[model samples]
Target: MSWTERQRALLGAMGLRVWGETAPEHALATSDAGLEDAAAPASPSDPDPAPPRPAAPERRRAPAPQADAASPPPRASPAIDLGAVAAMEWPALREAVAACRACDLCQTRTQTVFGVGHARAHWMVVGEAPGEQEDRQGEPFVGAAGQLLDRMLAALQLSRADDGDAASRVYIANTLKCRPPRNRNPSAEELHACEPFLVRQIELLRPRIILAMGRFAVQALLRSDEPVGKLRGRVHRYQGVPLVVTYHPAYLLRNLPDKARAWEDLCLAAGVAEAAAEAAG
Candidate 1:
């Protein structure tokens, strides 16, 4: 019934019992020094108390500075010249592309397809590289897949031509200017070799929107390894222009199920293009 009696009974149930003649509360309050002495059964002549420990020094932190409203703004990098690139004539540019031996892809390609479409179109479509048809025709997106792309553009009310120019309303190019052997995907080396030309093309065209068709084009443009499934249905940035990646028309034609997703991507791309055009106007 008493607390100590109950505690002893509880401990005894577990094959243990309270020890020492000290009162329960006094025993509980006893300093660790007492426990040490009790454990060793020290002689009464021993020092009655242990030496005290020195206190730890307090740590101090520096005060934070007050906010200043008149602080100067951080400097920015120099602005890039995207429009100046348009002044570069196609003839000279094409000549340079044709002469490029930057990568091994140049060794096998029949010819360079230095993009085709309106020079100043609001939209640019970047592909992986030229295929057999593109290499032979010296134009990007001109094969069966190209035909589907044309239809896709038509559906969006975008032409491959400018109002006065006979060229299409969209500019199309590849990550690689030249076709890889057997239509294989362009290697990183080939893409690197051809990237500068594409960058220049983007600078010159200054398209408001870029539609990177397929994974290779997306990877080259975005410098990402995320799958096209993850890349699609979102707007990304490429050299400051909005980019919407989707399945290549070639892929869409092969996997009919993906046609709906491709259509959605085109709609998003068209919306960006329309907004850019409106802003320009």
Candidate 2:
């Protein structure tokens, strides 16, 4: 789409340049002038007349064919059954993920990131999907974004890996097991195909608090299309677990100012975890 001044400013904020970019000329045109006017109908009395045509060549028409009753109808393909995957335990679930080919992403992915950290931690960190480093390392959040996430977790006295203490342990996983080609956004079908694995993980862990990072992660978990800015600063729930939305670490890296807002989200999540513990006690 053609970028407006406001859109250009937004792109600048995200550290992007709009100059020399190829975009549709009239993409940002928010007027109906180009559209056909429904109110003004064409009148039969209009002055324009049809032009005369020269002599045309004649051709024979083909006969209509009848349906063949002898031919059998084509059978429909069977749908992928997620029921078996949902019923699997941790080991079986990991195996299922390794062998999962329900989506096209499987063909491009080097390996499925089955997630790391404590299996039954009280806090769960969910990201959108795997990146290049993550896919290569077979772990989620492994690059600069992952480093930022580590610092954030350290600030909260939480560790994705087992730090020899159960209370400080936190589980980290992504919305999709496999990364999309070129790290593009995961399609609706891909998410749908991989959702059972995520759902099963949540069910098995039953984390008291879930921190959803990025717009896609929040959208998948909450089933809402609202932007992360709108969804943040408030606690939501997922399958009875307290869920909080926040900017992804990769987003925070580009928009440094939003890191403060992410910190706020983390604090809110911690509060929820404490309350849950007190209620349990």
Tell me, by lDDT, which candidate is best: 2
lDDT tens digits, residue span 1-281, model 2: 24466656554554433422532233222223422221233347845322222222232222332367786522211123456665788899888788676677877889999888887799999999999998999999999999889867766667998556656778899999998999899987777667878889999888988899997887678766667897687666777787888999999999998876777677667667766777789
TM-score of 1: 0.66
**lDDT at 100 for candidate 1?**
61
TM-score of each: 0.66, 0.72
| Error at 169, model 2, angstroms | 1.3
> Of the candidates shown, which would achieve the greatest TM-score relative to the real structure?
2
Predictions in order: lDDT = 0.66, 0.73
Which pairs in model 1 have colliding backbones?
159-169, 160-167, 160-168, 160-169, 161-167, 161-168, 161-169
- Point out the worst 10-residue segment of candidate 2 by lDDT: 49-58
Off by over 4 Å in 1: 1-88, 162-168
How do the residues 162-261 of candidate 1 rate in per-residue lDDT, one tens digit apiece? 4543223788888888888898877766665567678888887888878999888976777666678976876767666778889999987788777767
RMSD of each: 32.0, 18.8
Residue 186 in candidate 2, Cα distance off native in Å: 0.8
